[model samples]
Target: MKKQEQDHQKKNPIYQEYQLNLNLYNKGKTQLGIEFLI
Candidate 1:
């Protein structure tokens, strides 16, 4: 049941967008660190 829910979320486009937004926000916070992380 837990695995099924996790899989569903992974397939969700909204989830991917949210992840991207978080990453972008992180980059905005630390432009220099983001260069190394990416």
Candidate 2:
């Protein structure tokens, strides 16, 4: 079922790492944008 797949993703270390990287990338982008605006 779809719920089982979601659970599997939650347990996956690679996926977790990818998500953390994605968050950092987004934060970096936001900071760059603010610097450009100011």
Candidate 3:
């Protein structure tokens, strides 16, 4: 059941988009942190 859900997530467009946005948010956070440190 867990495996099936993971496979479904892999195929889900919304889930994929959320993941992309999450990655971008993390990268932006890192850049902001570096600017604050400098």
Candidate 4:
């Protein structure tokens, strides 16, 4: 995930778009984790 995100950042240096995608990715990860925990 870290490696993929790094590659994505390099592909898209636009801070706003990168941040948005990162936020969404993080939220998805959180949801998955919660489901796994449950």
TM-score list, all predictions: 0.56, 0.80, 0.81, 0.61
RMSD of each: 5.2, 1.8, 1.7, 6.9
List clashing residue pairs in candidate 1: none
Show model 2 residue runs off by greater than 4 Å. Answer: none
Assess candidate 1 and give its lDDT: 0.90
**lDDT tens digits by residue: candidate 2, 1-38:** 69998899899999989999999999999999999999
**For model 3, how does the per-residue alpha-carbon lDDT over 1-38 read when each residue is reduced to its tens digit?**
69999999999999999999999999999999999999
Query: Per-residue lDDT for 1-38 in model 4, tens only?
Result: 59998787678759668788899999999999999999
Better of 2 and 4 by TM-score: 2
lDDT of each: 0.90, 0.96, 0.97, 0.87
Q: Which residue pairs overlap in candidate 4's backbone?
A: none
lDDT of 3 at 23: 100
Stretch of 10 with least lDDT, candidate 1: 27-36
Candidate 4 segments whose C-alpha is farther than 4 A from its true place = 1-13
What alpha-carbon RMSD in Å does predicted model 4 have with respect to the real structure? 6.9
Full-model lDDT, candidate 2? 0.96
* lDDT (tens digit, per residue) of candidate 1 on 1-38: 69998899889999989989999998788997778799
Weakest lDDT window of 10 consecutive positions for candidate 3: 1-10
